[model samples]
Target: MYIHFIAIGGSAMHNLALALHNKDYKITGSDDAVYEPSRTRLLQKGLLPKEMGWFPEKITANLDAVILGMHAREDNPELQKATELNIPVYSYPEFLYEQSKEKTRVVIGGSHGKTTITSMVLHVLKYHQKEVDYMVGAQLEGFDTMVHLTKENDFIVLEGDEYLSSPIDRRPKFHLYKPNIALLSGIAWDHINVFPTYENYVDQFRIFIDSIVKGGILVYNEEDLQLKKLVSETTNTIRKHPYQTPEFRVEDEKTLLQTPEGDMPVSVFGSHNLQNLAGAKWICQHMGIDEEDFYEAISSFKGASKRLERIAETSKAIVFKDFAHSPSKVMATTKAVKHQYPKKQIVACLELHTYSSLNAEFLREYQGALNAADTAVVYFSPEAIQNKKLAPVAEEQIFNAFDRKDLQVYTNPEDFQKLLEQQHYEDVVLLLMSSGTYGGLDFNKIAEWIK
Candidate 1:
């Protein structure tokens, strides 16, 4: 089969392009700009476009399909070419669904923990010598690519994101998967720009549950009241299995799981992660992995790329970088770190980077979200707001949104870094949270400075 990918430089898009290429299909892709990892990997595989930018000429009638990425605008020249040629065009999720329609699709969906839970399932499956076609959000340790497809695998695991499928497709990506086995980690209102109301944001998950194939199973975090209520209201003929944070304890900065085998030590910690572990376990159980085998394998699962990833550690303190920007996520991460190290002074720094986070109205949701931290710091670049064409967020709004009298807000990255560097590092844990880099702040240098 021959296929072409438009806006293929995206993390998921590039990985999908490589997956099809590995499957021996003729694949070509075009993107206006390609960054590291995607650029290097595409170059290595000879899939890198000879020239950057949309080339309408590259879209040919002979191609089997054109996969569109969310990065591409509706007026993208290559997309227009595909339409003009009357060639089939599929959004990334739509194509993923087509490829795995025959397999037992296992989709992990939620406002958070989708990547971590999906990675856990993949890790355990690999440990048990089970081969499965999979697409996870983050780059995992043992996996060569984020997307993998095979003809032999009977199961396909997908990290189901609720974001729009593509510029042309407004449906949530997870809604297209229609999983036979589904897992919803939890529901926390996000994407304020799209779904302005909390109820609207929540209705998406309800629709996702209804999308499960008939007689399919849904494994959800029962601890989440919103998720629990959604599951209760659903009338679909699907099996529902509820999970909570499994028995676990933290000691000397280490988290140990109370498994059937015995107390199993884990590299990852916090209530949120433990809760994710329970959801993963249920999903794995549905996939034919025994409880004993799952626990044995999961003991070695460190974490996903940036989900509470340890950037650096020293005798005095440890610095962690996490992809947490939403109010609920920021709260959970902050509380987790404080819970794990009760004695350490926790300095929680979050960057208001996304459209939702930068919106002044949405900032109210973050009230008391970072209360767990001994020191709370929030940063948002006015330049970023301008770049996104958003209304500027003021320092007073930030302070009131957090409802913390001592909250320190910064609009400048240099000032933020200077303030951080001047703080006493001894007996303190630094938690850096953001979906974007702190305006190009070097994490490694900050880690060293903290040490």
Candidate 2:
């Protein structure tokens, strides 16, 4: 098949392109601008666009399909050209679904922990030498590319995101999956830009629950009251299973899971992670992995990229970098680190880079999120707010929102960097949480600080 990608520089889009290219398909892509990693990866695969930006003249009717990325605007010349030529155009999720339509789709969905849960499922399956098609949000340790597709695999594990599928298609991406087997980690309000109200954001999950294939299985977190309520109220035809945080103990900063056989130590820690692990276990069992094999494989699962990933660690101190910007994520991450090392001085730093976090009204959702940290710091760039066209958020608003009088806020990245540099590493847990880099702070330098 011959395929052309619109906005192929996207993380998911580029991965799909590479997956297709490996399958002996002729793949060509275009993007206005491509950033690091994506740009280099595309180049390595010999799939890089010869020239950046769209070329409407290249959109011929002979092309089999055009996969659209959400970053591409509806008015993009390439997209318009493809439409005019009557070539089929599929959104990223739409294409993924089309390929896996015949296979059992196992989609992991939630506000947070979905990536980690999906990664865990993939990790367990790979360890057992069980090959299956998969799409995960973050890069895993064993996976060369984050996406894999094959006609032989009977099942496909997907990290189903609730964000918009594409610029032109406003439906949440997860809604398009229609999974035969689905897992909802838990729902929390997010994407304030798209779903303006918290209630509206919650309704997306409702739609997602309804979209599950009839007679399919839905594994969810029972501990989450809101999620439990949703499951109870749902009239979907799928069989429902609820999981809770499993028994575990933190021993010498190591998380030991209490299994039916015995205490098994796992590389990943945190209450939320434990909950995610339980959900993954249920999903894995449904996929034909036995309990013994699931436990054996999951013991070696470290975690997903940038989700409580340990960057630097020593006997005295440890530093972790996490992709946590939303209120629930920030709160969970901060508490997880603190719970892991009760003796250490917990210093948590978060960057408000997302449109929701920068909004003054949404800031209130972060109330008491950083309470677990001995010292809490929040950083935001005024330029980002201006670019997002959001209202200005003052330092006072941040302090008030978090309900922390002594909370330190930084609008300048240099000041945050300096503060991190001067930090004493001894008996401390430095947790840096952000989806965006703190003005491109060099993590290598911070890793070197573990003395």
| Candidate 2 residue runs with Cα over 4 Å from true position | none
Residue-level lDDT tens digits of model 1 in 1-451: 9999999899999999999999999999998899998999999999999999888889888999999999999999999999999999999999999999889999999999999999999999999999999999999999999999999889999999999999999998999999999999999889877888999989999999999999999999999998999999999999999999988898888898998778889988999999999899899999999899989899999999999999888889888999999999999999999989999999999999999999988999999999999999998999999998988888999999999999999888899988878889999999999999888898768776876
Q: How far is candidate 2 from the true structure (C-alpha RMSD, Å)?
A: 0.9
Tell me each candidate's TM-score: 0.98, 0.99
How far is 212's C-alpha from truth in model 2 (Å)? 1.0
Residue 109 of candidate 2: its Cα lDDT? 98
Worst 10 residues of 2 by lDDT: 442-451
